[model samples]
Target: MTGDVRGTGDGRERRNTEIVLTAMRELFHEKDLTALDRYWAEPYTQHSPRMASGLAMLRAAVPTLVGFSWEARRTAAQGDLVFTHSLVHGWGPGPVVIVDVFRLEGGRIVEHWDVVQDHVPAAETASGNPMV
Candidate 1:
């Protein structure tokens, strides 16, 4: 939140970061599918092995995704790419840490990738460190 996107400078980078944040909040937290129209671009490329094909398949699966919410931990942007580190809930029995990278074109997200890991409670880990 303390990055260029929140306030620093370079309007384009700032705008792109803002777009990604709103899109994630609306889609993941609010579970508002309408965000797709406002924030996503067609011919979308999804790199995650969990999903198939392109935009249409993702669109089809959106409604089936439920009970989960996103808590953004960190955000950064360089040019058209925005990287977000977030904590997710209800996707499984416990929380997950997700590092997502999105590519935007003309202000709409056109490509996406993510790494998801089950959050390990501090008591369970040798280092006693929180994943976030």
Candidate 2:
């Protein structure tokens, strides 16, 4: 109620977006899910095909991965929604690109959605005559 109440909701939503992404980046690289309890609402529902809907499942399954690092490329927010595009690098299965969307309520992440795409190998250049 202090600073620009009209835009406050949108501003907080955007701020929460960055906060959530930062937390996720830290978790992905460090494998520390402790921030989830602090940043996410209870019974947070993530619309990921690979992750279960509850925090317990996340705590149990995330560490099973060999290595995972998520680097966020961009973020945009409107109303209470935040959209992010990111690239994930690691040595486990392979590199991946992830696009994520988050919905925040009262500055807390309430729901999440993401799509993961495997990084494609670069095309080989054709060189009829090899030059050193």
Candidate 3:
């Protein structure tokens, strides 16, 4: 919020966005779960309904997801909150479009919430628009 979003200066929100992007790349995309130690903070809070709310629980769940991957399309941040829109694969019947919200403290993720929907190909949708 410290710089003009449309200008050339390095905005604070842009830095926050980079932090989230780096975490996502190291943890979900690269399958390096240990990166969580550096990127995620606990006592963690998860608002995803099905998942538990501690870092240990999150750790246990990650490896269970075989062949899982996240491909981030874009990210935006405001204050301590950053959200990403992405295509997540291997967790659902097909590729799912996901918007993930993260609350970061001291540059580490402390809480999370997400909305997900099953992906429908462009031709199958009434608007014929891309999902991401």
Q: Give me the candidate number with maximum lDDT.
A: 1
List runs of model 1 lying over 4 Å from the truth: 1-9
TM-score: the better of candidates 1 and 2: 1
Candidate 3 local lDDT, 6-92, one digit each (tens): 212346667767777888778766767888898899888999988889888767877788778887776767787887888888888
Model 2 spans with C-alpha error above 4 angstroms: 1-10, 90-92, 121-132
Task: Summarize candidate 2's per-residue lDDT along 20-81 as a digit string, tens digits.
Answer: 67667556667788877666776689798777787787677668766566666666677887
Candidates' RMSD to native: 2.7, 8.4, 4.4
Quality of model 3 by C-alpha lDDT: 0.79
Instruction: State how far residue 81 of model 3 sits from its true place (Å).
Output: 0.9
- Judged by TM-score relative to the true structure, which candidate is superior, 2 or 3? 3
Off by over 4 Å in 3: 1-10
What does the lDDT read for residue 10 in candidate 1?
74
